[model samples]
Target: MNMASDHAHDRPHEPPSSGRRRFCQACIGGAAAITVGTVVYPIVAFLKLPVRLGESKPVQIPLDRLIPGQAYYADFHGQQVVVVMSESGPRVFNASCTHLGCNVVWDTAHSNFHCPCHGAVFSGEGQVVSGPVSAPLLEIPFEVKEGNLIIS
Candidate 1:
């Protein structure tokens, strides 16, 4: 055989169909699409506005439902609030602890609010009784209309 013919026979020949090349290109494209989606999905989700759980309206509770020296809990403007019936009248306060914004639980046995996070305590009247808290519970404005206790 001639030198050119011998050289051609010695070298490996590429497949005429090019199927393997097409398959590799498709795989690279798919991987790029997946990588871009993984990076962009979280950003798109974060940019979307959060769905609010509750409405921004006034909260109302019947005055008769309040028992003396007992605590009543309610949700107001997406925040947990508490109402305590004192001897003088009804008092409303935010249930969040002043120290670390933890939810304060009503200790019925002690007739006070207790913070489970940091061992803070609050009086039934929303005063800081003891523990790490320096500020009292936040007081919410309310009005008594007819037989309903209206909290705004």
Candidate 2:
């Protein structure tokens, strides 16, 4: 019997197969894709920040001077809005419709404001009355100052 037959080095060694190489390439590609996606997400979000943050400013309105049935239209913080009195209390809302950016008008006959573009109507309480609009009217911050309505 030969002494070299008992040695572990007698067996041949082989390199990794093509399947292993492909698996490693796929793993590396997946990691690179994740890294690129993460880096691009923040850049896109930063660019969109300005549009999401609308012109927000606090405005003062003379709530006491306004009558119950009267609705006053004014520019607040670069946003056009309507101030009205409801059964509960003074309410301020963005005159723009929830469905579209259409300006809503006060309908004296129905005692509610109706969006002419899409027929979206809102009650005196800022509640949705009818039409395709499902969201309630937005009420702004307001205060009474010496017989005046102050909105912010």
Candidate 3:
């Protein structure tokens, strides 16, 4: 064969596809997926974060207006909380159960709060008395300001 023919034959042949281009495309797709997940994860998590102190705007409630020994519910800082006036003083606690975030109902007959979701029982002071709950009721930071209950 001639010199040109020999040189052309010596050159390595490649498939129609470009390996480097394919690799780069795959890398770009992976990076895009990661970016989208990172951005969307936080947005969804922020929206789902449970109600905690300072997250809900605090409010002042006229606790004295409520009948003593009776439980009343009010929205405190975006959280559904129960306020009770006992001989000790005003008690404020989150109405949500610690076990599964279920709405607890006040058992006036039993003088305690009961979770209908799992039958968890909590004292009027928000202390867990029975059931599968490992933690006590969440207490709202509160103080009696001029006979009004201020929860923060």
What's the TM-score of each model vs. the native? 0.67, 0.57, 0.59
Positional deviation of residue 28's Cα in model 3 after best superposition, in angstroms: 24
lDDT of each: 0.91, 0.79, 0.84
TM-score of 1: 0.67
Those runs of model 1 whose alpha carbons end farther than 4 Å from true positions after fitting are 1-47, 50-54
* Candidate 2 lDDT, 22-138, residue by residue in tens: 799899999999999999999999888476364565566665566777788888777788988666677888888888878889876778989999898898777899999999777
Model 3 misplaced stretches (Cα beyond 4 Å): 1-57
lDDT of 2: 0.79
Q: Tens-digit lDDT track for model 3 on 104-138?
A: 89888778999998899998888889999989999
Best by lDDT: 1
Q: Write the per-residue lDDT of candidate 1 for residues 93-142, one digit (tens) a residue.
A: 99999999998998888889999999999998788899998999999989
Q: Give the distance in Å from residue 152's predicted Cα in candidate 1 to where it truly belongs.
A: 1.5
> Count of backbone clashes for each model?
0, 11, 1
